[model samples]
Target: VRPKFIDYYCPYTLGGHFINACNKDGEPVCGIYVKVSVERLNDISEQDAIAEGIDTDWLAESQDNYDCIADHNMSGRPTAKGHFSYLWQSIYGDDKSKCWEKNPWVWVIEFKRVQEQRND
Candidate 1:
């Protein structure tokens, strides 16, 4: 099966949810994002991918939680392993209370989905 790609954004901020809180440059801020392939989403329903989207809570987990399928993999770059890599964004603050005043972090992930073929 061919994989369908999607990009998702997380609405959660330390103070509150996106737009409601977290001010950036005098404007309500939205941060934290991810890129993933949901080839399996179509199997359940045509609109499943669009409706369910990415799981923000799962993506929020520590980077160590995910196994790296590839490294330094990106568009136009030669991939040593998988065809595509996952991408996500995050930020770290000096104090948990001041998450708005934080440093930005980005991640690219690589993974593969394997299925067993059945013969009758």
Candidate 2:
């Protein structure tokens, strides 16, 4: 089971623990926990939305060009949160407990990526 982010905080959580990963070249990546927090899904910030890889440009351009379903009153310039909300719905659908509109608590983990040479 996927333990909640809180599990990573308590002695039981692996948030602050050492985790290893490798890139395509098999170089070791030292993943060190830097921070962890929780936030409501709908309360995401523009910065966080962008960091999560929302494409505001495409939303705006498509809305301005061929998106007949877009809200007529909207100017088609999608904010980061707006774009993210659209993507969120696509993933979660309208599930009452999990959809973005329900504003569920989510885990936020920040880590430092340090790549090291392969030992072997």
TM-score of 2: 0.57
Most accurate candidate by lDDT: 2
Assess candidate 1 and give its TM-score to the true structure.
0.18
- State the lDDT of candidate 2 residue by residue for 4-110, as single tens digits: 23424656436655433555565555467899999889888998898888766665666343332363234536577766776777677854555766788999888
**Candidate 2 C-alpha error for residue 64, in Å:** 9.0
**Candidate 1: stretches off by over 4 Å:** 1-95, 98-103
- Model 1: lDDT equals 0.32
Give per-model TM-scores. Answer: 0.18, 0.57
- Once fitted onto the true fold, the runs of candidate 2 whose alpha carbons sit more than 4 angstroms away are 1-28, 63-73, 95-98, 115-120
Local accuracy of candidate 1 as per-residue lDDT tens digits, 1-120: 222233345444333333333333344233323454433211333133223343434434535434432333334422222111222212232334443223223233233433433457
How far out, in Å, is residue 102 in model 2?
A: 0.9
Model 1 weakest lDDT span, ten residues long: 80-89
